[model samples]
Target: MTTKPAINLWSSSDHAAEYLSRAESVPHRTEGESALLEFIPPSTRRILDLGTGDGRLLALVKGELSERLRSEGTSPRVEAVAVDFSPAMLEAAARRFAGDPSVTIKIHNLDYPLPDLGKFDAVVSCFAIHHVTHERKRALYAEIYSLLNPGGVFCNLEHVASPTERLHDEMLSHLDKTPETEDPSNKLLDVETQLQWLQEIGFADVDCHWKWREFALLAGRVGAS
Candidate 1:
């Protein structure tokens, strides 16, 4: 007898469409996004956004950088690369960034090794990495570390596992979702293990920067310049 694979509906057009409709309303999402942006410095020249759904967070970050540049009355060039695997999501992001010469959108899955896209000053992901298996999550963290330049930062506005099933259910309830209705693609893991993995892998200043229920920001620096 053979066991079937886990269901990941993100690749489905309907699922991707459904998510885009509710993407803005996730509890404290803006707060999380705001906190994630603070870590990225204005001096960053290259950015990589992983699992960049519809390029929303990527756009926000770029916008913030632009605002900063405007305030300083100096314009510095910033280039961004956004990656996602779902065909529907890829199209959405490409369309979202269409005619924007600064952003380059690519299609790539998080379950596999990342493509050779050189290095980035900052790497970011928003609630997208938990879909991969727990083992792969650690490996991906390592890969992200390798892809960063010294003094670079990695910011992840992530969905993490609760300490108990009861808390997990409560979190879902707060989001107006139940176990039966929740996305089967989620493979949540505890924060401690992930932080430990980051430290063990040689990251500096690693921590869960902010959190609300299951939504948290995991950030780490590559090294001091």
Candidate 2:
């Protein structure tokens, strides 16, 4: 007997477009995004957004950092890289960041290792990353750790696995989605396992900053070496 290959429907333009249409409607997503932003260091000058669908979370981080800088009477400047593999998502991100010279959009699948994009002061993702295989998830966390500047932060507002099947069903109901209707691309991992991975990867202050059902904000800071 052979195991079937795992499915990832995000490559389909229709699937990607459909998700974008309802992206803002996910329950408690804004709250998670807000919590994720709070973990970003106010001094961050360079940021990278992984799986940056439509560049929503990246835009929020950039805006928040700019506000922090302005309040300190310093020049507000942030250079960003937004990455996504889906053609539809990449196009959306491109249009969203169009005319903003500070934001660079890159195409890369999360299943493979990340390209050399240099170090960043902050790295973020939202409702993404969970699409990768469990092994890839751990490897990606390690890669993220290696990409950070010392004292840099990683914030992932993600769709995490629930502790129990009943709870998972309940959460799905809250989102008006049945298990059968859930995204085939999702490969949710439990929060504790992921937090442990970050800690093992040498991240400091590893914690789940916020959570609402399956949605969670996991964050950590790289130590100054």
* Candidate 2 vs. true structure, TM-score: 0.96
**lDDT score at residue 70, model 1, on the 0-100 scale:** 88
- Evaluated against the true structure, the overall lDDT of model 2 is 0.90
Q: Return the clash pairs for model 1, or none.
A: none
Per-residue C-alpha lDDT of model 1 across residues 1-225, encoded as one tens digit per residue: 121245567888998999999998888999999999999977888999999989999999999988999899988888999999899998999899999899998888888999899899999999899888887888999999998999999999999999999999999998889999988888888888889999998899999999999999999999965
**What's the count of clashing pairs in each model shown?**
0, 0
* Cα lDDT of model 2 by residue, 1-225, tens digit: 121246788878998888888888878888998898889988899999999988989999999988888888998678999999999999999999889999999999998999999999999999888888888889999999999999999999999998899999999898888989977677888999999999998999999989988899999999999
lDDT of model 2 at position 133: 85
Error at 172, model 2, angstroms? 1.2
